[model samples]
Target: MKIALDAMGGDFAPQAAVDGAVLAAQQLAGKARIVLIGQEDAVRPLLEKHGAAAAELELVPASQIIEMGEHPAKAYQQKQDSSIAVGYRMLHTGEVEAFCSAGNTGAMLVGAMFSVKPVPGVMRPAIANFVPKLHGGLGILLDVGANAECKPEMLEQFGELGSLYAQYVLGIDKPKVGLMNLGEEEGKGTSITQAAHQLLKVNPHIHFIGNIEGRDLFNDKADVIVCDGYTGNVMLKMAESIYDIMADKKMQDPFFDKFNYEAVGGSPILGINDNAIIGHGVSTPLAICNMLLQGYQMAHSGISDQIKNTFKS
Candidate 1:
């Protein structure tokens, strides 16, 4: 398998990206190949500093770097030669099996959707992240900022996607699915959530677990959580912030550190044709390395093939 890395897409670009790539290459020596995409000159020195060689790895030059502050769409369009854009291009063209980027979230999503396109029958690709629950495990949240405004059908589809992810990545035989809402009753949330809840409950492909309130998310209420991008994104950010606040207090919170997006790695952009893991701009070496391994795993996980079969109906 070939994994593409955005060597200059994050705040710690070139250095962090290079270091992470080296780590991944060493860890998965025979399992996968690394392709560093960015300013080769700058990245090459970092590779040497780590006492590693990228001779077997491909260096795809990207003349531009997308700034975190730039508008995602605008940056991707204007900076055609950027690492994010170039890496995505490789993914779309099948030159690489997966593309990993610790760049602007918006830019990364934009590149995946526009560059590689969504899977067949997939209306919109969703961003799914893993959050550790208080019950000593983790829950996967979908549509975490992709489509803020979603129809009931979209939410149901997110449920399907999240289920596949949980089953395959989390090793759950039958992951429980939950709809984010105000209450656990049948008619609890707004029309959208209510409609989504009903649809997911009837969807035989998933193990629907009924409604889950925000307060119950970390209580081990469900293994997979589905919400519209707007709500999911807000919840993800808020949850991360609370954890960070606690960590700042230097509290003995194992959950806060283990489940952090940066620590567990980044979120995957589901429904894309190829493996594309999106990371925050502030990702560090460990986070990037984790994302790199995730890229390798998903690329060969038969996810795209499964999605094709699922959409065939």
Candidate 2:
């Protein structure tokens, strides 16, 4: 299998991306090959710097680049030869099993929709983030920054999407799904949440655990927390801030360390027909490496197929 990465997408691009791809290549040696997509002139020199160590890495030239500040839809449409665009084409053509980029998040989502498209029955594809569990392991949070406003049905689908990821990729069995609300009670949220709760409770696809409060984020109360992008994005940023604060204070706690973005690498765009992950803009080599590994896991787990099958019925 082949895994693709946008070599020029992140702030530390070409160098950090090259270094990360090499690290992932070393770990995934004999298992999968890493494909780097970027401008030839910019990326080749760095790969050459690795000597024979980089010989195994494949470089695909893409002259154009989608800048971070450019409008996602406009940039993606105009920059057809951009690294992100080229990577998506490769993924769509089955040349690569999965694609990872720390570039523009909006562009990644645009590529997913325009290229591989969403699952047959999926209303919308969601951006999923990992949550550190209090007891052990990680939980799934959906719609992190995808659709800031979602309908009741969309929230219901987010639950199913998050459940499939938790079960297939995270290796959790019968993952408990929960609606992130103000209270644990079923009728404690907005009209949308109340309606979504009813829809989720009867959905046989997941083990619905009722509504969950913000404090339950790290607890066993829910393995898959469902919410609109507006709420989930806030939680994700808050966790990131906490991690940064702890690092500044030199706290060094194991649980808090899990909050580091480098640990998970990137956020997977779920409910799409193919696997695609969006990484942080300022990704370091370590973060990029983990993101590639995550792509490999998503591809190997056949999570996309699982989602298609579930939604089809």
**Top model by TM-score, which number?**
2
| Model 1: residues with Cα > 4 Å off, grouped in runs | 53-56
**Highest lDDT against the true fold, candidate:** 2
| Residue-wise C-alpha lDDT for candidate 2, range 107-146, written one tens digit per residue | 9999999999999999999999999998989999999999
lDDT of 1 at 44: 75
Give the TM-scores of the predictions, in the order they appear. Answer: 0.95, 0.99
User: What is candidate 1's TM-score against the reference?
Assistant: 0.95
C-alpha lDDT of residue 98 in model 1: 89
Judge candidate 2 at residue 47 and give its lDDT.
92
As for model 1, its CA RMSD to the true structure in angstroms is: 1.5
Q: Which ten residues in a row have the lowest lDDT in candidate 2?
A: 48-57
Q: Model 1 residue 130 lDDT? A: 85
